[model samples]
Target: MDLIDRYIYAVTRRLPTEQRSDIEKELRGLIEDMLAASADLATKSASGPASDQTNATIRVLKDLGHPALLAARYRGSSQHLIGPEIYFLYTMVMKIVLLATGGGLLIAMIVSLITGAGGNPFTIILETLGSLISGLAAAFGWVTLVFAAIERFSPEKIKLDRDDIFDPLDLPEIPAKKDRIHPSDPIASMIFMLIAMVVASFVPRFVGIFWLDDPASNFIPLFNSAVFMMYLPFILATMAITLTREIGKLVSGRWTLGLALLSLGVEIPSLILTIVMMSNKDLFNDAIFTQIFAWLHQSDPFYFDLPMKILVGRIVIGLGVFGFVVEAVKTFVFWIKRAD
Candidate 1:
């Protein structure tokens, strides 16, 4: 019974979350039918002790074959950018490359801060953030390109991951409830974080106020460039921490006490830094607001004064604090339940 549950979990976990529930039901029905048929066949042929039922169950499972292979069947195709034969190798190589890239960029950033690189601190931080983003992206891209090429071009004779020969007995042990992780979760999070980091690092100037009737050249940036650059280092720090957490999940394929603690450790400081950055009125482009008022053909009003700015900052800080609390609570709950 546990085996059947494990097999179903394995097969459905590989699928999209929206499809998992339907597929799980389908798998259960199929397994039940197979077992019933096997029972009837065994009854007609011969009689035996309880061991016969156990043997029948094993036979049905073996006939169903490996969970990965079954999942592929349900997916309707076996093709992939990187085929099964080298997928494990691809992931391993990717982890190594990403780690190396992150570590190198981090060292460079620290050195720049210490030695007072040619530029001011704000400019130096922006540069480091850009370099970090580009370096990690390049590493990810090159490794993936090479691996996909290998998967496509390699000789037919080359195979791995039990591709040439597979055995149901080789099925992995069923992980504990807390230990099971859907690969897609961490992967999707990483993609989102990467996009956010890129926008923050390279495209802050493009984030601006624009008039629908005017040309793009008339755009006024939302934040003073110099002031924005000063906050880039904070963004960089949070991105690094978030990326590290996701990578840990990816590599371990599960949550651990260390990972949970790492999240809380970074989250508190990140929230503080975010609040400090958001509360700074100097970051807002005074010229941009003046231009906005001029374009509206209205004089500056008391409603758009210091108190208004303080109100907006308070709203942002409130939302940020709520988010931080939710994330912290989730981490603590998961860790506590798993520990129990």
Candidate 2:
């Protein structure tokens, strides 16, 4: 039955991939046996085989309890920092945090390379790697600590009828078959935005280019630091708005009118800021441009000029605006279709 298959999927999904097939086999066998026993008893009593056994399957699943809890039982009673009741949520949060940390570190590395943060390329790379590892460890520890505190101090238990803790009506609606948002989409966006914010605001010096000719003077900062710093607040605000929208999407598990509106709100200001930044003459470092052009001239006998740089900046900004508009339109369309 479809319900049976769904039930099996729900349970097996919580398990490790390697264990899922074996556990599924065992679970299906046990369920079949239980159903057969029930059918046999009914048959003897009624002088015929049981006509409808779907209800029997439902009863079996209910008795087995929540799929997450059932999966935990199969995993055995090991002492855990977080209990089964909130284990799924804990894991999800950990995954998001870890992904964000990794992405942030990657951005930082790119920025460092471009900005020539350190005289030595190897040192910059090593420093970035170290930061990435430490950041991941810190994120993991913080998440575990938070979940552990919840497990220990929260008086509310995740009981089946825990109405006081949560309202049934507040639960997220199940998406229509064709309209479901893939979990990875919001997750990846959140990570990317988190990285962008960290690199842009806190580690702006890392946003430069590197050269191999002169080891000590190989890096060039992309932006005039003073000008970039002045715009940091606006940049950060846009990133924060987008980050919040992504988080909301992750929690709600789908796009909606509210999310689309929120996205538009973020995009409008972001687009404006993009225009302002691109138009400002102080945004680009003249020395860096000169150095890069000098290197280019030496290699190809072609000159890089102001108009070329302006054109490139405009192209980049145009692409960003185009992307924002496309996403906004898609979100609005999805929301409308879902509503209808």
How many clashes show up per model?
0, 4
lDDT of 2 at 236: 72
Candidate 2 structure, TM-score to reference: 0.53
lDDT of 1 by residue, 101-207 (tens): 67655655664454442246788678877887877887688667766766665544254522677566965567676566677777767656655665565434456
Best by TM-score: 2
Q: What TM-score goes with each of the models?
A: 0.49, 0.53
lDDT of 2 by residue, 188-265 (tens): 886777677667754447766765665554656788888899999899778766765565565556556665677677
